[model samples]
Target: MTAAVRSTQQVFNLPDLGEGLTEAEIVAWRVAVGDVVEVDQPVVEVETAKAVVDVPCPYAGRVVALHGSPGELRPVGQPLITVAPLDDGADDAGRAGAGGADDPGGEPAGHAVYREEERAGSGNVLVGYGTGHGPAGRRRRRVGAARAGTGRRAAADDTAASTAALPEGHPTGTGAPVPTGAPAVVGDASAYRSRLDGELDAPLVISPLVRRLARERGIDLSAIRGSGPGGMIRRADLDARTGGPAGDGRGAGLAAVPDLRPAATAAATDAGADAGADEIVIPLRGVRKTIADKLSRSRREIPEVTIWVDVDATGLLATRAAINAAQPDRPVSLLALLARICVAGLRRYPQLNARVDGERGEIVQSGRIHLGIAAQTERGLLVPVLADVQRMDTGALSAALAETTAQARAGTLPPARLTGGTFTLNNYGVFGVDGSTPIINHPEAALLGIGRIVDKPWVVDGALAVRKVAEISLTFDHRVCDGGVAGGFLRFVADCVESPAVLIANV
Candidate 1:
């Protein structure tokens, strides 16, 4: 008679979400034990040092266990969930017994060992863990023939002996090797033979744990030349590829990773070496940490130079007034007008709308003007990208900016809305600041800062008169262009502010 096979549990570990982060606070869990999940379905929402990211489940199975609760910090490589692969309804004891003696575990010997190569996942891996590949092919299980005088202890003893015989450092538990001379356990031996032949035809990369480890270390697995049978990616091959163990010391040591800040700020971080009781230390994490890392990287990496020019904004203010007078109910913001001028300036000097690709050793100039507007929210400052600003008119641009700013302030802006910007327009003037240099948003080569347009004494047409004056500051990466390009872009914008007719002519 065929013996019923006990379901095997597969533990899914928390993957290092490609950000080089060690741990994340579990914000919420989307699944509970016993719930069946499909591949790529979001299993949890975790708050990393950079942002709140949704992590997806790689396995499609019945959830057997969940490891952490909400608000608990879980480290990379910790077991997150357990799953039991569903069985295919096939009963064939004769085929199972064909493999002969019981498995070293003392159970029906012919039960096929589940290979790790069969595991599947969705290819959509976020900063958090998801399967690096697509869905896996379906599999079947075989029931073994019952043996007399066999008990749980006997099976456990046999399993222990098999584990004891393995060489040191080899994977144990579910990864234990199949016994020698074991037949393929299945309903139809010929069908199983055909399937095995097909699988053997291709080189299989079978270790999810190894993949996760490689990802955490920023090691590209595909580039690694596998040494195992069928060119499989083994631990030894990965060791050679990475030149060390999987542990990059990200969880325990910060010194190993690249320093984000320059020496000055690094020294300043220790200014309060002896922190007083009155001092409140804020830990760098979440959005604040993300901002720090980005801004510091921008300051350290980009050779930025700022140039400012005070403009007679009498015409820009007059244009705004004329628009308001024409449409009293719908008021035009000064920032939107500034955005239009920026788009025009970028058209004349398209070199500023680019990023220095250090890896590729080239400058990628973007064709579209995806403008990022800086907004200060309750949580922190966030730049929500207003895509394709070159396509929008003053009315449309104004509406889009207002809506995006509202979303940013409400803390409901999606991650997608915060990225993919070609240029940034910062209206510090709204804060009533006269003139100040701003940090260039990383990746984007340039940022234009607009100061307050206030009534001031200005010499226009060689006459001293009270006119609306504003200051425009342009901060640009020197690698993309020199002072000639930056100065021209700023000067053109100043001209537009001084005379709106240039903008009208361009339009």
Candidate 2:
């Protein structure tokens, strides 16, 4: 019998870090080439559109190569790391007994084979393996024996060429159908040209952005010819059809496009067209880019209405001081007290806590309260969410808010903790501002802005007296509720601030 052929090298692709992100900047690498790593071990740290996250490697093997350097941007589904998998043909006993002397799942000493099943992943979605949404099939393909003067690269090239050269709907030589959802590789240009020439009736369009562009521009997607693999329509194809409109036009708004492509790439492409010695250009990247895209979208899509109310915060301030004096060790923050009042108000006006699902034409009213606390860190502004805020008491809410704030400052909050908020509480008072018409965080229908609590002259029992006062503003989505509901929510919150007894009774 001829010698057995073994499959080894496996390339891991950069997985989607969620929030429909398409690319990420590699922050740092945890492992170097020739270093052995275990499954679910973090191989790299990347900064996505939402947050900085650690990407785990799904395969347990010796790292062969890394694709990108630190601070370099890599597209989703691109090669992230290459691993040489353990040989699979070893004896069953050897594979089974390969457990470590110290632990059951630990690495075995000596030359025993490691079982693939033994190196199972963490099942978490952020493994640098596959798109988290799809069935995660391995990127393994069997190759034929190498010819003279050709190596593994040549074999892979030949396989791709043969696959591309096959007639439409034809199978590979092994009678196996083409893999569905497999990433398209560089194939024979002549074969692609021939297919493009013959098949121009309906273009293969996959990107949602391309479809949206066609819908908006009244351009027929079927009428356009695609230059991508398998006749896939590309952004360039649409740009060509649109004649690539100039300077703050229909196309300019799409430049800082999120989800589809990196905003930096578009910004760079635009800046490259007008590179001048006197120009000072800054790249739209990382936290700044994310903020820009989100704010721009919120401004464009949201019909926001801002309403402000002045309140006597004397009772609220007294309650906070009394609580701190009673339990100095477990003191509650003033902001947390305000948050409690906001939560109580939301219970009375649930419409303020709900989101308007415009696509579905429905108002999604949340049953449970998940509050987003906006904090400014060195990186930028980030909102860390506290789940089930209605369950937390004053002390617990204060502790949770403090922990999240510290985590944000330390840049250690997980991406999951930064999302899924039904409502938002913005404390702009820390900056000593009296009031601001802050933009409502997208998807969350309303945001409550808290101002500084200061001593001001107020009417107390129809007499002018100095009292603790504050200004509160509510920015709400008009589509979710009308001015009446918005005013009621603000009035209820102001009442709670004015009389802490109302808040305690509601609680």
Candidate 3:
């Protein structure tokens, strides 16, 4: 044989997937220690700014270690995985231009990147290391774009570009990019401004989707400013600039432009959503990308089996109220009760709490249950796991739910909090939904959809009895379970919800 193709490890630090995204909530990891990964393979999923994203592994190798678990917030540039170089401990092999006088990774073997742009007359960069005591006023060319290999906090420091890295001489201000038609004097350029779209300039940092939206709406993206990181273009930026109901001032879907008016009735006859309405366009990055990838995978790869049921939740609600009163100060939600019920249900239908080893063509069933609570936030959807749900009581489940929601909203949830969920509980009831077919979170077998509880008249015993009723939908993996089993599992859930004491006895 000629020789082994030697390669070095590139600890691909997390890039700013979200526009000017400084941080992300780690949703899940696809690879584990000792698993071989191919380049471009989705290694991790994260949620950011209302969207989820999947980060593809840049290098192929065996995963040596993972930094954390799901729901954990990892800052940009943090090491997510450690890959063994193809060279196998040969430091000299495959090493490139990563050396710097002071590189934080201490690799001293990275590519050379111009950290600061040289302005026509400006002496140096705003931060340290750019200042040199030489020619009284020797200027540097601010023509080149800044090199960003790590997380750079892009603020609305210059112009309203959400993710703009300021020009050495550009007046400091945050609003929108130089109006769409503004001085096309410069090419599609970017640096680090965090108004909104600044951090999203992958390779070149241009918001292609946002520009496309603007063009389609008959509004020039350049004309509309940004209000996000580095002054990047945001949905609101476009909405405000276009006035409202964009284009013809009519309400429309994500594809329709915003109406120039604020009255809801103004665009009543339009397609849908304020597509071009009061909104700023943010290109999906980081967590948002992760979310998209996971959801896409779940919808695409697995054959989801959805089953719906309408249950009288009157008893469940009353039990919850009484339990809360008994444990005063510790509120218990219907979900807590549902969670306890689902955990117990899994005891009878173990397949729903299992994973498919596609590689081995075998199904791996888990005796213990890890419950994932589908959390909705301003950013997007996050399902932080309630590990060992089979073991927790209603009170413990209540505490976990409260803590998880609080941490999720605070943007302080840990990766561990978001991982290890074998079964997912999605409550669409909060939105008054009667029933819905939810997608299954893949690698796992099932996701339980909870619908709104309403006062519906039902004929019980003999006469008509008005009671609070809730709807539930169970979506499972057909490969791991059949309709008969899935239906039985859901019925078990309904029974527990109707009879609250079963949960206590099961525990």
Which prediction has the highest lDDT against the true structure?
A: 2
Model 2, residue pairs in steric clash: none
After the best TM-score superposition of candidate 3, give how far the Cα of residue 415 lies from its true spot, in angstroms. 2.5
lDDT of each: 0.65, 0.68, 0.58
**Model 2 lowest lDDT segment of ten:** 136-145
Query: What TM-score, to 2 decimals, does candidate 3 have?
Result: 0.51
Candidate 1 local accuracy as lDDT?
Answer: 0.65
TM-score of every model versus the real structure = 0.52, 0.59, 0.51
- Alpha-carbon runs more than 4 Å astray in model 1: 1-278, 328-330
How would you encode candidate 1's per-residue C-alpha lDDT over 1-507 as one tens digit per residue?
A: 233432345677887665467887775565544344566665666666644555666676555567887657899889887765544222223323543443221223444423233348755655223334222111112112222332111223333433433334444424566443211112222222232322323222344334445654566765776675335566556555644323433464543554434322432332223222244355566677788888999999899999999999889888999999999888888889999999999999999999999999999999999999988653466798999999999988999999889766644455667788999999887676899888889999999998888899988779999998888899999999999999999999999999999999988
Tens digits of per-residue lDDT for model 3, 1-507: 014422334466776443355887665554444334555555665665544445665565545557766657789888887665433433322222233324332223443321222112232211111233111111100111222354221222222332134433333223224332111111121221121223333322133334444555566654444665444564456556656433434445644532333222223222124353554444455545667777898888788878888887887888988877897888887778788788778887898999888899999999888888887654456777778777777788888888877556544454556667798989887765688888787778899988888899987788999988888889999999889999998888887777766656766
Model 1 vs. true fold: TM:
0.52
Per residue, candidate 2 scores C-alpha lDDT tens digits across 1-507 of: 112312455688997676677999876565545335667666776778777656777777655567987668999999999776554443222333454333222222342443444366556656322324222111112222222221111334435643543334433524454442222221222222223223424345544345545664567987887776555676677667766533236666776553322434443443344332255366578767888887888888889999999899888888889999999999999889989988999998898889888798899999899999999865578888999999999999999999888766655566678789999999888777799998888888999998888899998889999998889999999998999999998988898888889888988
Clash total of candidate 3: 103
